[model samples]
Target: MAVDPRGVDLKRLLAEDSGEPLVMLNLLRFAEGGAESYREYARRLSETFLPRYGGEVLYAGTGSTVLVAEDGQSWDAVIIVRYPDRTAFSRMVADPEYQEVTRLRTAALAEAVLQATTPWS
Candidate 1:
């Protein structure tokens, strides 16, 4: 039920760099009454941090009916983001300004799955 990434997580992400664009899959479970905060975080990210860090939100949406999953496995939202590279992603998370905004995301989520993806050859 971890809602935020730790320093070690970022370090591990960097260590696995492929020198190619990195895509991150985000599965979010919102805390009660926390949707608005997450929206605000997303807005700021799309408007400023993303551009500054060479990142783009590929897709974002609320989860609908679960097509396939365990009873409690349904997510509240999903977002896919692409970064120029793992370094760019790492830098964004380390930015002082971004650090401030990230609190909204952390507070909004009860649980989250933030996983990096590799495209097929």
Candidate 2:
């Protein structure tokens, strides 16, 4: 049921200064008729916000049958997005214009997991 990060979450993210590129792992579950809405959100995000924040989609794909997972653990889609850094990601989310378009994404998902990943060295 956690679709978007909160202000506190962003603050916490910013407090950790890794100073490295971040990859966000997104696990999404759409509500009925929500995939279409999410598609629109994705289009707007890619065109308007991503470049502004130096972000890019590494991968996006619809989920299929889960070969291995706990019960009630399957997702509807998965997306991996790379951002220049945590600050860039934070700024993108806080942008006024991006906030307006985020409504579509909020409406589209029943549940989501947005996790920041650092490459293992």
Candidate 3:
């Protein structure tokens, strides 16, 4: 099933098969406030990036992990998205939506790291 972070559905993805080896990642970060730019970026992504990435997001969501650190003390939300292949992920980041909104995301995020890994099943 697709459960990367809290974005989309998994079973409908095209680039990956549930039984095949999949890449998993855990995105860790410290972001807060619902009104911040990152939230807007997320909204825009929900509107733009999601559709743009399409199938790539499905493969990416499976086996993904997201963690939000302490509330008021520091961190906020964590995100993890899957990709059928590292190359596909690389391409997605270079896409126009990512290129623009990513910068906005960084500005809102205090600390973020994309932990891309392969999980053996």
Indicate which candidate wins on lDDT.
1
**Cα shift from native, residue 99, model 3 (Å):** 1.0
Off by over 4 Å in 1: none
Cα error, candidate 1, residue 72 (Å): 1.1
lDDT string for model 3 (1-121, tens) is 1112222222223234444333444333434552367667766766776556542233212212335645533324545555555445545566775777776666665554444555654
Give the lDDT of residue 57 in candidate 1: 94
Q: For model 2, where is the 10-residue window of minimal lDDT?
A: 8-17
**Deviating ranges (above 4 Å) for candidate 2:** none
- Give the TM-score (vs. native) of candidate 3: 0.53
Model 3 has a clash total of 2
For candidate 1, list the clashing residue pairs, or say none: none
Per-candidate TM-scores read 0.98, 0.97, 0.53
Highest TM-score model number:
1
Q: Each candidate's lDDT (Cα)? A: 0.95, 0.95, 0.48
Q: Tens digits of per-residue lDDT for model 2 on 1-121? A: 6799999999988888599998999999998999999999999999989999999999999999899999989999999999999999999999999999999999999999998887899
* RMSD of each predicted structure: 0.6, 0.7, 10.0
Name the candidate, 1 or 3, with the larger TM-score value.
Answer: 1
